[model samples]
Structures are given as C-alpha cells and as structure tokens.
Target: MKKTESISFQDFMNESYKKVKRRSRPYRTFSFVPFSPFAMLDPTILTIGGIVLGVVLIERFLERLGVLDIVDKISSVMRFLFPLTFFGAIIYFLVTF
Candidate 1:
C-alpha cells in the first residue's frame, strides 16, 4: 500500500539555525532622542480629529431629535439642485463680465 498524504518538508531543515545573529541595529550603538516630547507633533491632525468628533456628536444629537432624516432629505435636494445653481452662477458671471 502507498501513502496518499505525505508530510511537508521545511526549507530550513537543510541549514543550521543561528542562535544569536540579529543585533545589528544602529540604535544599539547610538543614543536616540525624539525631537518632540509629544507622540504626535502636528496640530492639523488634532484639528481634523476635532472636526470629525464634532460632526459625529452633532449627527447623533440630530438623530436623537428625529431630525437627521429631514436633514438628509434636504441635503439630497440641495445636491440635486447644485448643478443647476452652479450653471446659473456661471451664466450670470459671463453676462456681467
């Protein structure tokens, strides 16, 4: 009888493994100091995070008052009418110029 399934062979089985060969990093020899004390130095990330937080809080507040759906409807209508208004403004600009 022949074996239907055979065990897999590993690539490292032919080579001897090194016990300690991975401590060549530059930080091992040099002292490292961060330029900024804070983890994140850029304030733009904080500003954007604040805007996102504000939007989420306001959306939740509107949803709790049952006004989020109404706001969505108004936004959709405004989106649909945006192109027409944009074209009207372009035409007015061209005529007045």
Candidate 2:
C-alpha cells in the first residue's frame, strides 16, 4: 500500500498566494449595472446587510431573554417605586377634587 503525505503550510500558502495574485489583476473593461443612486446593487452588499440584520435580530432575541430572566427582579424593584407612584396619584386626585 502507498501512503501520501500532506503538503506543508508554507507550500499551501505559496500556491494560494499565486492564485490570488492571478485573480487580483485588473481586466481591460468593467461593466456596471445602472440602479437608483441610494440603493446598493452588489450581492455581497446585500449579504452584508442580511448579516447585520441577523445580528440585530439575535441581539433583540437576547435582550428579550434577558428581560424574561429578570422579570422577577423587576417586580421586586417595582415594589418601592409603586408606593411613590401611588402617593403621586393620591396627591393628584386630591388636588383635582
């Protein structure tokens, strides 16, 4: 049986760099699509936008989960605030009456 050895990281990096160098050379002409000035026309831009949107969505999900986790804490803290709120309401009622 014959066994093959894996290429070293330096050799892999050299080949990858060569491929990137070839692809990165500029061509003679570049065509552009016409679109609304403010709108992004690149698919990569849309993908980036989608990623940002996903991050925001995940952040909101985490925020809601945190709020759910802290609901009992909120109620305990509101015990003190409620008295002040009630006092204000009673004073308002008396002044209005």
User: What are the lDDT figures for the candidates, one per model?
Assistant: 0.57, 0.57
> Tens digit of lDDT per residue, candidate 1, span 1-97?
9867433355246444333477765654444662344534346444545655665576667778989787686557656665665565446544543
What residue pairs are clashing in model 2?
A: none
* Overall local distance difference test of candidate 2: 0.57
Task: Count backbone overlaps in model 1.
Answer: 0
In terms of lDDT, the best-performing candidate is: 2
Best by TM-score: 1
Which 10 consecutive positions of candidate 2 have the poorest summed lDDT? Answer: 33-42
- Give the residue spans of candidate 2 off by over 4 A: 1-39, 67-97
Candidate 1, pairs of clashing residues: none
When summed lDDT is taken over every stretch of 10 residues in candidate 1, the lowest stretch is 11-20
lDDT of 2 at 20: 39
Cα error, candidate 2, residue 91 (Å):
60
